[model samples]
Target chain A: MEKTILHLDMNSFFASVEQAANPNLLGKPIAVGGGIKKGSVVAACSIEAKAFGVKNAMSTWKARKLCPHLIVVIGDMTKYIYISKIITKMMVDYTDLVEVFSIDEAFMDITKTQDRFGGAIELAKDIKRRIKERFKLTCSIGIGPNKLIAKLAGELQKPDGLVVLREKDLPTKIKDVQVKELCGVGRKTEEYLRLLGVRTIGNLNSYPREKLVKSFGMAYGEQLWQMGQCHGASEVRPYFYETQAKSIGHSYTLPKLTSNTEEINGYLLRLSEQVGRRLRRENYKGNVVCASIGTGDDKTSSHQKKIKDFINDGYQIFKVAKSLLAITNKIRFVSVSVSGLLHQLDQISLFSHVENQKKVLAAVDKVNDRFGEFTIERAAIMSTGLQGKTGMVPPKLYGLRNFKMELRGIEPLTSRMQI
Target chain B: MVKVGTIIKVGVVFQGSKIIPRWFIWESRKYEVRSLDFTWEESQGLEKIIRFSVRDGINSYELAYNTIQMNWALENIC
Candidate 1:
C-alpha cells in the first residue's frame, strides 16, 4: 500500500507557547531568545515579529533595530518541552507509528489508521483542532504520500495551514520551489547546485544523474535526485525506538568569558561528571574521551584520545579532559564527551581495583538520582560555584525516558521482585 | 514592575491533580490570584521549583514553589 505520512509543525513554537501563557503577548510582536545581551540570538519569533523581517537566530540587537516594539523574552526550555510532550501524547492517540522530529515537529504514518478517522486530511484537521483547543497554540500540518513531501508541503503555508500533497500534485506543486526547500539541502549544497545550474526542483530533475553523482558522492547524489522527485523514507519508526547512542557529551557556556584556567577546569570537571553520570545511567562505558574548548574569539579546538580501559567515572574523564585543556587559553566554553562505547558488563580483574571505584560511584549515583542531579558533588567542582548548574537536559524526545527501563532490558520497577 | 525574590506565603487549592494558586501574601500585602496563565517546573540540582504565571488585577506575577525547600517565593512581577 502507498504510504500516507502526515507532518505537524508548531507555529513559532516557543513564542507561541509564551503567548498562550500570557494573554498580553497575543497578536503582539515578540521573540523568544537569550538575555537582553548584545550577542543573544532570537530562538523563535511570532508571526507579528516575522512581519517586521525579524527572524530566528538573528542577533537580538539587530532584531530590536528591525522592530523597535519587538518584545524580547528569555526562552523557557522546560516549559516548551512540557508542552511538546502533551502534543506528542495527543498524536499517539491517532497512530502508533509517530516520529518526533524535534521539540515542535512530528511525523505520523497514518496509512493504515486514516480510514478510522475518515481520511488523512480529516485526521490532520482534527489533530490540529484538538491541539489548538487544548494549548491555545496553532500548527501547520501536511499530508503527503511520504515524509519529505509532507514536510515541504507543510512549509508551503504558515501559522495554521493544512496542505495535502499527493503524487499527482508533485510536478506542478514542487517544480518552482527552491532546491533548498527540500530537506538536507544546506547553503553549501545550494551553492554547488547553483554552480551546476540547478536552482529549482525542476532544474534538479532535468540535470543528469551521473553528473550530480560526480558532484556529490553516490549515496547523497541519489538521495538528492529522489528528494527532487518528491520522494522520502516511507517508514515512520515509533518515537521510543532506541537507535544506539554513538556518543554522550555535555558542554557549558560560562556566564562570563574568562581566561582563568582554574575556573575553566572546574567547569570541565562539572561537564565531565554530567557525561559520566549519563553513561553510567545508560549502562555504557567508553574507551575514548574527547574535550573541546571555545575561546572568546569564537574559535573552537577539540582533542580526543583512546584510553587503555573502558571507563565511566567522572574523575577519570575529567583527568583526560584536563590534559587536553593544557594547550588552550582564553577559553569561554568547555565540553567533554565520550565515544567508542561498550555495553557495560561485570568482569573480575585480578590485578585491577576498579570494583571499589564502581561501588562508590554507584552509591553516589543512587543518592543523586533519589534526590536530583548534583545533589552530591565532587570536591574539585565544589569551589567553582557550579553547584546548582545542571548541564542541558538532552531533550526527552517523545517522552522516551519513560520507556528507558524497557529499552535497557530491565524489568519495570513495579514488576521487579523486591529485595 | 516590581522585582522581588522575597519568600512569601501562598494558599494553594488542589483540584484533582492540578495545583491552583488561590491567594498569596508578599511584603504584608495580600493579593488574590485572578487567573493562572501558565505553569512550568524547573530543577536545580535536587531542588524542583514549579512556577506559575499568575495575574491579580492589573499586576502579573511569577509565583514559585520549591519542592525541596517547602516554601513559596514571589519570583518576579510585571
Candidate 2:
C-alpha cells in the first residue's frame, strides 16, 4: 500500500508567534533573537524582514544594517515550546503515527487515516484552519507518498501554503529543482555533487550509481540515488518512544569575560549541578566528565576524563570537571558534560555509601523542584552570583516531556489573555 | 534603550490564577497598559523573573517582576 505522508511546517514560527500575540507587529519587519547586544544573532526572521535580506543566524548588527527599521525582540522559548506542544497534541488527534521533525515541523502518516476526513487535502485544510483559529498562526502543509517528497513540497511555497507531490508526479515535479533543495544535501554535499556535474535532481538521477558509490560511501551514495528518485522512508514513529541520549551537558556564557579562577570554577560547579540533576532525573549515569572553556579571542579548548566509578552526583561531576579546566585566563564561556551513559541501577555497596548520597541529592532536588531551581545551593556557589542562573537550552522537538510535566499545575498566562 | 536595573512600581491584578499588570508607575508617572503583548519567564541566579511586553497607547514597554526581590522594574521601552 502506498504511504501518504504530510509535512506541516509552521511559518516564521517564533516571529509569527510574536506577531500573533501583538497585532501591531502583524506586517512589520521583525526578527526574534537574543538581546540587543552587539554579537547577538537572529534565530528567526519574519517574511517581512527576509524581504530586506535579513536571515536567521545573521548577526543582529548586520541585520540592523540591512534593515534599519528591523524590530529585534528577544525570544521567549518557553512560550514557543508550549505552543509547539499544543500543536503536536492536535496532530496526534488525527493519527497516532506523528513524527515531530522539529519544534515547528512534523510528519504524519495519514495514509490509513485520511479516508475518515474525506481525503489528504481535506485533512490538511482542517488542521490548518484549526491552528489558525486557535493560535492565529499560519503553517504550510505538503502531501506526498513519502517523507522526503512531502517535506520538499512543503518548502516549495511560503507561509500558508499547501502543495501535493504524488508518486506519479515525482519525476516532473523534482527534476528541475536544485539538488541542494532535497533534504540531507547540505553545503559540503552540494559542492561535491556539483563537482560531479550533478546540479539538479534530473542530473543526479542520470548520473551513474557505480560512480556515485565510488565517490561517496555505499550507504550515502545509495541514499542519494534514492533521494534523486524522490524516494524516502515512510515510517512515522510515535513520539512516546524514548530515544536514548548519548550525552548530557550544560554550558553558560558569562556576562563579562573574567580571568578569576574562582569565578570560572564557580560557573563550572553550577553547570555540573545542572547536568547531574538532569542525568539523575532521567535515570542515567556516566563514567566520563568533560569540561570546556572559551576565551575572549574566540579560542576554545575542552578536556574529558574517564572515571572508574559511574556517577550522577553534582559535586562528584564538578570535582572531575574542575580538574580538567586547566585554569585558563580570560575565559568567557564555561561548559560541563558527561558521556558514556548507562542506565542507572540500584546496587548495594557497603563502602561507597552511595545510598546516603542519593538520598541527600533527592532531598535537595525535591526542595528545588517545589520552590525553584537553586533554592538550595552549595555554599561555594553562593558568592559566585551564579545561583539561579539558567543556561539556555536549544529547544528540541521530541524531548519536551520534562518541561510539560513542570508546567502541568501552573496556569498558563496566555490562556487568561483576551487575545 | 535605557540603562539596566531601574526599579519601578507596577500595579498588577491577580485574577485567581496568574498575575496581570494593568499599569506601571515609572519616574512618578503612570502608563496604563493598553494590551498585554507577550509574557515569558527568566531566571537570575535563584530568582525567577516574569517579563511582560505591554503597550501603553503610543509606545511599548518591557516590564519584569522578580519573584525573589518581590519588585517590578521597567526593563526597556520602545
TM-score of chain A of each: 0.90, 0.88
Alpha-carbon DockQ of candidate 1: 0.45
Off by over 4 Å in 1: A326-329, A348-353, A390-419, B1-7, B12-17, B41-51, B64-73
What tens digits encode model 1's per-residue C-alpha lDDT throughout A262-300?
A: 788788888788788888888888989999988878899
Q: Which ten residues in a row have the lowest lDDT in candidate 1 chain A?
A: A405-414
Candidate 2 lDDT by residue in tens digits, A1-419: 88999999999999998887666788999999876676578999999999999999898899999999999977867668767877887887677777777778989999988998989999999999999987789999999999999999898887899999998888888898899888899999999999999999999888888888888899999899888878888888666556777888887666677889888888888878878888887898999999999988879999999999888998999999999877647878888989999986556668567778888899997777666666787787878876655544333211344543333433333344455
Cα error, residue A3 of model 2, in Å, equals 0.6
**Candidate 1's residue-wise lDDT over B1-78, tens digit each?**
356998999999989978999999987889999989888776554678898989897778889999888899998885
The model with the greatest TM-score is 1
Report clash pairs, candidate 1. Answer: none
